[model samples]
Target: MHFDLADLRLFVHIAESPSLTQGARRAHLSAAAASARIKALESQLDSRLLYRDNRGVELTPSGQRLLQHARLILRQVERLKDDFSEQGGDQAGHIRIFANTTAVTEFLPEVLAGFLAARPAVTVDLQERLNRDIVRAILDGSADLGIVAGPVRAEGLEILHFSTDHLVLAVPPGHALERLGRPPTLADTLGYFHVGLHEGSTLQSFLREQVERLGGTLNLRIQVASFEAACRMIEAGVGIGVLPETAARRHQRSMGLSILQLDEPWVVRERSVLVREREALPGCARTLVELLRQVGDGVVAP
Candidate 1:
């Protein structure tokens, strides 16, 4: 029973993707070729790997174990390549980061721009994901680093303080909530129609969870894709919105929106950086982490 690195790589892509065809595309293989390879791999292991249905494929128990090992092995292989490249005076590599919406939209761009400018040989694959998914990706070796908001419960991961942000309500000037002259709890704003983030946004999902916990539902007047759009809608008096304080401040004057603090514990949020093992990270990845730490320290304003 033997499988090559290519087979392992393909399997990893397939397991991570939504469909076999998509996985094949990621691996730069035709669908038929990828299917044949998977079959051969299953035969070599003497176990079924994936359960196929109309929607897509789900990994079998055996496939799940293989995926775990495969990701670890691939990460090790990439590290090995990085080490050799560094020895040859070419410190070039790719780093994958999974971050939440706030980090993605409000924090990372400036930092990433400078980092990329300095390290011409390094490439970054940054993806927006939910905090929980970010933690899972780091633990599973699928992501080199993660920036997550709120509490983290991952036992073995290294957590670094990144930044602090708050969820604030964005209201039009002279809105009823604004006239109240006090920090309003989420419950207090439940009756007002709201401008909300897109349905797929992690922040939106988080807000929905909070609303459900409070035994209320959002009376959404409109749903937009970004903080800016939500601010625009709020400024137009379509509705109020819950947005990051960082974003609210940035657009407050221009958008003529009032930013109100929420009287809730969860409104104050801490963003943290996560890694499986910092010392074990690739050289380029480690450098990126340090740069992020500098930003957190206020040594460099991002």
Candidate 2:
């Protein structure tokens, strides 16, 4: 029995969207056509692949298992084709990457520059989003890779540690917190007005948990979406904010802010690079991953 690549592609899309109508839109096919294809694939394999419910579709156990092999086969086929076509001279392709702002500004530029210098014909499409969105992008296959400030665990994604950052407390110059000679505990931090990223974001999630564990409450005065915004708010004396050390350091001089170490041990953040699956990475995606790994190892050329 033979399975068509189109069928596998459709299946993956279905798994990602879970709604037949939405999946068809993403695949640029009509609902009837997408349903017919799924039906045909299921009939050909003599197995039910999906279950449609009132809300959306879900992959059966068999379908879930097949997805792994499907991705591996497709990636291998593409890689084989690329290998026979060229030997990596000015490789022509595009890679989709999603990253958080810190990585977008701090880490990605050097790796991207090196990749471009080596493969000028290729193009990099980068989107700066929050860590949660970055995780979803990788799982949906919309992004070939994701760089995020938190660990991502999903059905089909593999995460590799890329870097670690400290989450430092930032206060405007001469703020009361800045003058505190001793590191503030949870109780002390909560007394100060807080500015932080909005809910449903990685930093917010992490901070909320830490605050809860510390048995303290945050004033939570302002909720901004970006780290830069948080820093600016702190500089304006809106409130104290927590931000990545790299970002806070970069802007502290200009913003006239002071970075204070939190008294708790949970203030450090680890960042990672995520791929949908290792064996399914396209040639371009593999090269990009290599660049990230090399950069993480501090072996990249300046």
Give the Cα lDDT of each candidate: 0.88, 0.78
Superposition error at 291 for model 2 (Å):
2.5
Checking candidate 2 for backbone clashes, the offending pairs are: none
**Residue 300 alpha-carbon offset, candidate 1, angstroms:** 1.0
* Cα lDDT for residue 291, candidate 2: 72
Most lDDT-accurate candidate: 1
Model 1, residue 174: what's the lDDT?
91
TM-score of each: 0.92, 0.77
Q: Give me the runs in candidate 2 sitting further than 4 Å from their true place.
A: 53-56, 87-90, 93-101, 104-106, 113-162, 274-280, 294-302
